[model samples]
Target: MHPVSTPTVLVDEEDRIITVLAGRPLGDDWDEVHAEISTLLHDAGPKVGKPRKQERRGDYTSLSFGVSYGGGQRAPGNLVQGECSRTVIRDISQTKAVQRAAGFMNGCFAAYAPKLYEEYRSNLSQLFAEYPHLEQIFPNSVFPTATFNCGPRVVTLDHVDNTNVPFGFCAIFACGSYDPVRGGHLILFDLGLVIRFPPGSTILVPSGTLRHGSTSTQPNETRQSFTQYCPGGLLRWVAYGFQPVGSAKPALRRWFEEHHDERCKRAVGLFSKLSDLQQDRQAVFSLKGSV
Candidate 1:
């Protein structure tokens, strides 16, 4: 594994930060924390039956709680807002272990991608505040949903999570005992970058917009990943005044149509560039910051 003393930022043509390869910032106790999370996952086991083509290998558990859209229904019927918990870790002990891991990754997300993290927190707060019934997997976690790639061998195919918020960032935390150099490298096809991902490291990336996956672990090695993200449908629900687009008033619908492009630009603007990282960090970590 390449020791990363500082974060490696990837930017697009417009200098918009697309990915922030956050290094191992878990401090001296990283090994202990990784072991605890690994043990929790092993005890919980795989929640899914078979490996899909996109997943390549190993089973996964998606613990989601938020609004979702587009499973092929008519306009108004398509959008649905509610809890969808497919998590295998249900015991109180297991839940706490998972939450601890999530908290660590959230801290890294806040540190590396301050602007995007801030927007995520604001959007999440607004969604939950307006709709009190929505279930949050972890109270401290900023992301609305989380997925545990429970793996004796967890490797994925290059694909984009199109259902996730396009401009939003997803936090991925690597766990288990895997050799970073031999395998377990993060591959970003769109950016043409292959990043050596050491165990206990966290990275924040625009998973919905980029094609990404990881390399396979070597023989006798194990790799697991925990990922957190928010579904795009929830944001759309907020934008449409907490209702499905089809049911929204005509004036509201018209406004959305007219301002869609402007909204997209603003969403893109939330990403912090490399040059602005210092200022963004200060803004997010200041005493009066929103967090």
Candidate 2:
């Protein structure tokens, strides 16, 4: 039998965050989600195959487009290039087909993953309640958004959102494979935590709090997942479509600065002790700066 569950909307006093694991498998709504995704893909039309070539050490480009559905019209926007090769920005409310797709996806999350959805809603509400400044800009609980990152070997460079509102984000992995050997782990740089989520597993991350990215994949390996950002404050609404901006930048910068200093001190101490272990050999000097 499933364990007695707590109200997912309540925040943990220790971490001041809310996280809920659903009691049921997301497969309960898999058919509905799949159909909606299929319709959206069909409306997206034929994707012009284009190889995403990396232009710089950390920069890669891909072709993408936007799907907007609202007021009984399913309008497909012109294809545009993005940082990832297989990315596409889908605007659900701009097209009837997309609106249906969004509704289906939202329903799946709310029904099959009610716990996760509740946590997301609770966290965002709490954030806005505490940070009244954010509500002034983004009064809506949900933000108008589009996502364009989904493909094999897709790499999103380390970055932060461009808003001051506290937001909760989630990524539901639907990729069929459950193997750890597959390159689909979500890496959280700030916490040094790597999460390997199998298909049907949903991860709730405190957006504007964590810096994360995905691992690279082998050839012929494709990964599928859905990511959504829920708004918490007014600033979030005002900053929509501008870029990800927030206090996270300064916070991350400070963390890295202090972290590097600590690492330097440790390295110096380790090197001094290593000299004794190596009989003060000149050969060990070459490995001193390795880390």
Which consecutive 10 residues in model 1 have the weakest lDDT in total?
A: 75-84
lDDT of each: 0.71, 0.39
Each candidate's clash count? 0, 20
Of candidate 2, the 10-residue stretch with the lowest lDDT total is: 67-76
> Can you list the residue pairs that collide in candidate 1?
none
Q: Write the per-residue lDDT of candidate 1 for residues 1-291, one digit (tens) a residue.
A: 334447777788877677887776536666777767766555444433433533432335333333445555322121232222243434422455567767867877777678778877777688778766666667677887777666766787788998888988888988778888899999989878899988877888888888998889887887777888877777777777767788899998899899989988888888878788788889877865544
lDDT of 1 at 195: 94
Candidate 2 at 43: error in angstroms? 11
Model 2, global lDDT: 0.39
Candidate 2: where is the Cα deviation over 4 Å? 1-13, 18-141, 170-181, 230-291
- Collision count of model 2: 20
